[model samples]
Target: MKAVILAGGEGCRLRPLTNHCPKPMVPILNKPVMEYSIELLKRHGITDIIMTVHYLSSSIRSHFGDGSKWGVTITYSEDGMPLGTAGSVKLAEQMLTESFLVISGDILTDFDLSAGIQHHEDQLAAATIFTKPLDLPIEYGVLLSADKKMDKMFEKPNWSDLTKHSINTGIYILDPKIFTYLEDFTHYDFSKDVFPAILKHNEKISIFEAEGYWSDIGTLATYREAQFDMLHHKVNLPSKGKEIAKGIWMEDGVTIHDDVTLKGPIYISRNTIIHEGAIVGPQTVLSESAIIHEKSEITHSILWENSYVGKSCSLGGMIGHCQIQDHSALADMNDETVNAWREYTKRDS
Candidate 1:
């Protein structure tokens, strides 16, 4: 079966990182989120895919060209204008000749796609949405279902009903016939427009409750938490237990000096260098070719590829590409000293 991955979102929430790169290209544990989705689809024997592209389309095409690297064939639906979720699918109607699945590129999950498709086929519904239960339905809209079949969708209800049912997980097994309900290249949203229209027409739409690890890493906190989850084996990712040191994992050709101190749960990509007296770690990621200068400290941050951390520096709560000025230092370095230190201080002074 072919699958359509909705990768056209602007990803306004993950700014600066998504400023240059597309949302699907954003790395989760040094691997693109879109790659994980592709791997999952390939596992289910869905080798043909149509990825809807808008922002930084070339980057995505360049990264996953031909899909042969991942044992799949990828065709892109390059949107000239910003098309809504359903509209994007409508734009690729010609490619989706049979029943297919539509999933968000930004979401990360190991939901049973085989079961979802099976459920869709068994029920013979026009569309089958993958749903999961959430503790806090207020944070997300509650999908009302009866006897394992979706009845209505209530968006963010005011009162908390104990019988609060499932929520849409943004994964759907859709029959090609559903495309007839969508308009091309228009601002037609799947949730707001298409689904509601389908409901009005009294068409068969079902929901399948997923049972497995699932997460939507939409915020900074959730993104950081996903890294921790991968470390703890709560989620299955490629880099889960690849740690070389106690909390550090170095790729091939990484060089670290004896004077360099690395804390646990840090990942340094291939060819990264740690200079003398540099302290890296406590949950940090130094991408390829990143240079850690002498006496520098980094904690709870992610430095993009080829960034340079200056000498005598401390970087905390940071992210993405940068070049630190030489001789810069963070204030909380000297625990014994209760006063602030100069930003640029000489070693002899």
Candidate 2:
């Protein structure tokens, strides 16, 4: 079966991080977020895939060219302008001749797609929308059903107005004929326009309640939660690197001097170095080639590739490629210096 990955979102909520990388390319556990999506699709035996790209299209194209590295054939549909979710998939209508699956690229989930497909086929519905129960439904589009039929759909409704906690997971098994409802080069979203229109016409749309982990990493808070979830094994993501010590994973060429303390549940990527007297960890991630100087301390933080923490510096929270001077905290760094650091750490790839 063909799969359509909606990867074109600008990710305005995840600023700074998304400033350099596309939303799909955002790092979770030192791996691009979409990489996990591709792996998940492959695990379900769905190899023929189409990815829709808009912002930083070339970067995504370059990173996973032809998808051969992942043992899948990848076709890209680039948008000249921002096409809404459904509109973007419409651009690839020719490739999606059969029933297909649609999923957001920015989300991190291990939802059983195979089961979802089975449910879709058994019901013989025109479209099947994967639904999950959310404790807080205000931020998502709520799906209301009665007698096994969709009755109402509300997008980001107030708490007082909510009747159902089941929300759309942005994963769908769609019939190709659904393309007929969308126009080319126009902005149209599945939740805001297409799905509602289908319900209005009394078309059969199945709703499958997802059973496994699902997280839409749309904001920094969710991103951090996803990381912690992975650390706790709440989600079944591939191991980031070699587990050299208990709760501490490190890649090849990692250098650590004596007297450096590394707490558990941390990932140190390739070629990173922790100098003497440095204390790292307890839910921290150091990206490739990061340098933690002598006596520096980092806890509950994520450091991007080639980041430098000077001697005696203390850092917590999300930090990119910025360099912290000796004895300096993150707040001591100015915006100009941070921008310069980001530019310096920019990857040519």
Candidate 3:
């Protein structure tokens, strides 16, 4: 079966990071988010795949060329214009001119696609929207179903709608004919435009509800959380971090000087250095080429590539992302810096 993966968004919310890398290319435990989606599709016998590309499309094409490595034949649907979710799927109609599954590139889930497809077939619906139950459905679309059949979809609900709610998982088994609803020369969001039109025509838009792990790596906090989830084996991956010791994963070419202290759950990426007397991690991630000077202490933080932590500095909930001119210091700061009561002043300025 063919599958359409929407990987076209600019990922505006994850700026600074997304400024350098595409959202789907952002690493979750050192693996691109799109890799997980592709693996899941390949595992479920969906061999032919079409990626709808826009911003930074070349990076995606370069990384997952031909999909032969993962036992799938991949195609690209490069969108020359900004197409919304439904529009992107519609734009890929030529590739998916048959029954196909559609999923977002940035969403992380272990949802049962096979079962959803089966359910779609059983109902003979034009579209089968995968539904997930959220704690607060106020910000999401509420799928109303009775007797296991989706009757209607109401988006951005109030308290009343929250009582009988199921939310769109952004995964769908869509019939190619649904492409007819997509109008030309406009941005058409799936939830706002297409699904509503389908319901108005009393078309069967079935719901395939799955109770499984689902996460959207949309922000830095959620992205970090996804990494932790992967480390704990909540989401299975081929390699669950490299083992430098019994319970440590130090990246290749990392330099750890003598007398440095480290606790478990540390992931030091390639070319990072921990100088003498530096204390690092009980839970920390040092990105590639990071440097920790003597006696500097770090915990519960994520240092981006090429960062440096100065001597005697303390960090908690920090994110250091780059180096300063002349390599004399790092552009480092922390939650402590943001807290006004700490009375800490910026000396680098």
- In terms of TM-score, the best-performing candidate is 2
Candidate 3 C-alpha lDDT tens digits along 1-349: 7899999998887777788677888766556788999988987888889999999999999999999988999999988888898887777676777788989999888887889888889999988889888876676678888876777677787787555768888898888777788876568988888878887877778888887777877766566566655555566545434776744777678899999998756678888888889888755778777888888877766777678777777776555374422223332345532342122112111
The 0-to-1 C-alpha lDDT of every candidate, in the order given, reads 0.78, 0.85, 0.76
- Per residue, candidate 2 scores C-alpha lDDT tens digits across 1-349 of 9999999989998888888889999888778899999999999999999999999988999999999999999999998998899999999999999999999999999999999999999988889999999988788999998755567788898888788899999999999878878888899999888987787667789989889899999977677667767766678778568777777888788899999999977889988989999999766889888999999989767788788899999886655566788998754245643453344225211
lDDT of 3 at 64: 93
lDDT of predicted model 2: 0.85
* Ten-residue region with minimum lDDT total, candidate 2: 340-349
Clashes of 3: 0
Q: Worst lDDT window (10 residues) for model 1?
A: 339-348
Q: Could you tell me every candidate's TM-score relative to the true structure?
A: 0.89, 0.92, 0.83
List residue ranges in candidate 2 displaced over 4 A.
242-246, 331-349
Candidate 1 regions off by >4 Å? 137-139, 156-165, 330-349
Ranked by TM-score from best down, the candidates are 2, 1, 3
Tens-place lDDT digits, model 1, residues 1-349 = 9999999887887776788988888877677778888999998899999999999889999999989999999999988898888888899999888999999998888887998999999998888889888876665557888876767776666664537657788899888887777766687877777778877878888888888877776765556556555655566546622666555676787888878888877788877888999998776788778998889999777778888988888887676776997787543234322111121112113
